[model samples]
Target: MGEKFPEIQGGGSLILAWQVRNKKVLVIGGGEVAAGRILNLLNADAKVVLISPRDGLNSEVAHRIERKQVEYYDRKFEPSDLDDPAITMVLTAIDEPDASTQIWKLCKEKRIAANIADVPPECDFYFGSVHRDGPLQIMVSTNGNGPKMANIVRRRIAANLPPNIGDAIAKVGALRRKLRVVAPGTEEGPKRMQWMSKVCLKWSLEDLCEMEEQDMDELLQSYAPDQIPSLSQVRLGEEPGTWQFDGSFGWACVV
Candidate 1:
């Protein structure tokens, strides 16, 4: 008998954050799809150029055009638009299939990444569900297969996260900055990072959010005395064997 192998699933796309701030982005439609893409680009601080026939624009898109938030070209897309050296990416949501195909081909020839709405095979990327909390942003994708499912998953994950998670992250960042100054050495970065990871693992999100600088300094003294000069001889008044760490059972302390 011949050997058999398990079937593999569809190829997954790599998720990344594109640095598009202040870069030129081209959108080739002015309907709801184009409006949504424009808003997302604007949120990222990208300079957008929207091109579509004047009669084809939706009311919302027209309103933005009237306000001059975006550079609106009241005409159909032309190949010359792709020739702009400043254009970093292109997005097409035109109803005409031929126009969409032409835009995709032109983008490929120009080595510019592009997304064609409702056409996964023609797109270089897919629009995914995004959830943002301060500096923390989460993106969920279904490989251009199921957008509704991706949105549902994104909402569920967002709902389960603690409201103070962003605050906790900010506190940790401040602690890291302080540690860098107080503990200047070659291995300071990795050592402090490891200590911080351990602290995060052991402490609840609420505790992290509420912890003060003095409390963090004490924690550094207890867990990483060698890293900081001021914490070398500082002790938490606990015996050597009072606290124990078990690989399988986690951390425990004697009462």
Candidate 2:
């Protein structure tokens, strides 16, 4: 029999962690959907400007306007709204079908990315269900196929995750910074990474999260003899668990 290649699967959208910090985004509605978009944008530290009629404003959107959280005009969206070259993204969430389509068209003409709520086909991108804990974030997307289902999946994933994985990450970051300074210079980069990798693997998630600032200080101070120490050595009488620490990393091991 002749050999054959496996069948190919179709491609999906390229999910990205786009940074919109300090950039301007235009939102062309004042309804609840637009309010949610505004919250998400503000969370990203984007400069948001909203356009909607004064009467169309939902309570949440109006509260934002009252607090001056965003710059908005009390009027409907117009063609001139896209005149600003600084606008990076546009979102519309109004009941007017013709107006929403017009906004999407104008955005396409201006080469500005857009998302029209409930109209996935017209959207340049989409909002995913995000579960965030401090510096850790998990996003669930259905590629515009299902929104509610995405939320359900996200909720389930969030429920199953460790309670404070974010804290563990923060602890790692703290150690990395102190370790870098203690062992600085270009030659120390490899040593630094190898040592940190061992630290991440050997120290369980709960143990890392339990580490405090003083523990870090003592850990740094105990960095004698190749700068590797067991948890029991550092803690004095505490159990070291099952992790074996050889204090050696990288290649070239002779048997």
TM-score of each: 0.74, 0.81
Q: What value does the lDDT take at residue 133 in candidate 1?
A: 78
lDDT of 2: 0.81
Task: Please give the lDDT score at residue 208 for candidate 2.
Answer: 78
Q: Of the candidates shown, which would achieve the greatest lDDT relative to the real structure?
A: 2
- Residue-level lDDT tens digits of model 2 in 1-255: 699998976645778888999999999899899999999898888999999999999999999999999998999888999999999999999999988999899999999999999998899888999998877777898988998999999999999988878888888789888987887888888777776776676666777788887677666663333354555556663333422467443222110
Question: What tens digits encode model 1's per-residue C-alpha lDDT throughout 1-255?
Answer: 698998877598878999899999999999998988998898899999999998999888898899988998989999999999899999998899987998899999999999999999998888899988765678999988999999999999999977877777777777767777777787677776666666565555666677778766665554444322122122343432344432232222110
Model 2 alpha-carbon drift over 4 Å, by segment: 1-8, 180-191, 217-232, 235-255
Error of 2 at 95 (Å): 1.4
Backbone clashes, each candidate? 0, 0
Candidate 1 TM-score, C-alpha based: 0.74
Relative to the unseen true structure, what is the C-alpha lDDT of residue 185 in candidate 2, on a scale of 0 to 100? 87
Residue pairs clashing, model 1: none
